[model samples]
Target: MMVEIAIFFLLIFMIIGMLFVLEIENLLSAVVMMGAIGFGLSVIFLLLGAPDLAIVQIAVEVISVVILIRATIHRDIKERADESLSNISSIPLLVCIFFFFLMIYPALRLLPTFGEPVFLNFYSSSVYYLRDGFHLTGAPNIVSAIILDFRAYDTLGEAIVLFTSVIGALSILRYRNRKKEHNAS
Candidate 1:
């Protein structure tokens, strides 16, 4: 009963937020609308009994929304230039959206039929005894055990390995912005 009430209120808030976001002329209003929507969706997730996903979504939404609002708040609100997004070519955009939905549909549908999962098909399931850490090993945290103790330096070394990749990507992207990049860096 309480869950249904929470869902109803969340739905109402989300609809109001969407309308505000779409109709608002001011950027700050739009940001607030979107943030409200994000927070409302987070609450909806919690009501649906997915607390883990709700926590992750809330954290990500909060950080990104704050960054967006902070950036847009400094911009000139008085500059009300009418722009036509309809003039832009939307064929490619429609095609991308269609392709994404097509891809995601099959993946979502397959989630249920994936059955007893990979471990069941394999020699023995690791998920059941993952907490034990290979029959009473010292590692309490499964992920920590896998990353730090077992794999150890393999994880730490990847950061160092990715340094060159980052530099290469930046170099490629900034080929035309050499002067700007040099000044910023």
Candidate 2:
């Protein structure tokens, strides 16, 4: 009873959102509508019990809306947007778009719809792993073995990427502050 009502609501919002995205003339309006679509999808995910993904979708949707809002503040929006969406593309972008969608088509169609398995057999797999593997892997902790043996390089690279991103953000912020100070002086 409740599930059907939920689906009906989701479908209604999705239909409206799709129409909004398609019918909107302004780029900003379309961006906002796309965010709405993301939010709606996030709600659907939440209803389906994927809390992590719902959070990610909400965060991404917020960022997209904020970026679109920020981009409109300084630019000559009207003049830039006077060109039709078709006119906005160059040969390079068109080729890139063609290849990007072409790349995704096979993967998107063949990919399984994402969600957790209906049943989790924790007692079987987790029990076996706990009982075995100290001799084979020569590691005391299963967590340590998984991280150090299988994914050590991946973990190291991720840590390096995080460090690099933090440094890059700090550098960019300092540069912006200095530029502002210089201009103000």
Clashes of each: 0, 0
Which model scores highest in TM-score? 1
Give the alpha carbon lDDT tens digit for every residue of 62-135 in model 1. 88788788779788574253444555466988999999999899778767442246565555635544746655
Give all TM-scores, in the order shown. 0.48, 0.45
Q: Rate the local accuracy (lDDT) of all candidates.
A: 0.75, 0.74
- Index of the highest-lDDT prediction: 1
Q: Candidate 2's residue-wise lDDT over 1-185, tens digit each?
A: 57557857997998998887666666677777888888888988888766767897999789878977777656534434344557554788889999999999999887654443323345665455446656657888765665576568987997899799879967976887798999999
Give the local distance difference test score of model 2. Answer: 0.74
Q: What value does the lDDT take at residue 70 in candidate 2?
A: 79
TM-score of candidate 2 versus the correct structure, residues matched by position: 0.45
Candidate 1 segments whose C-alpha is farther than 4 A from its true place = 78-185
Clashing residue pairs found in predicted model 2:
none
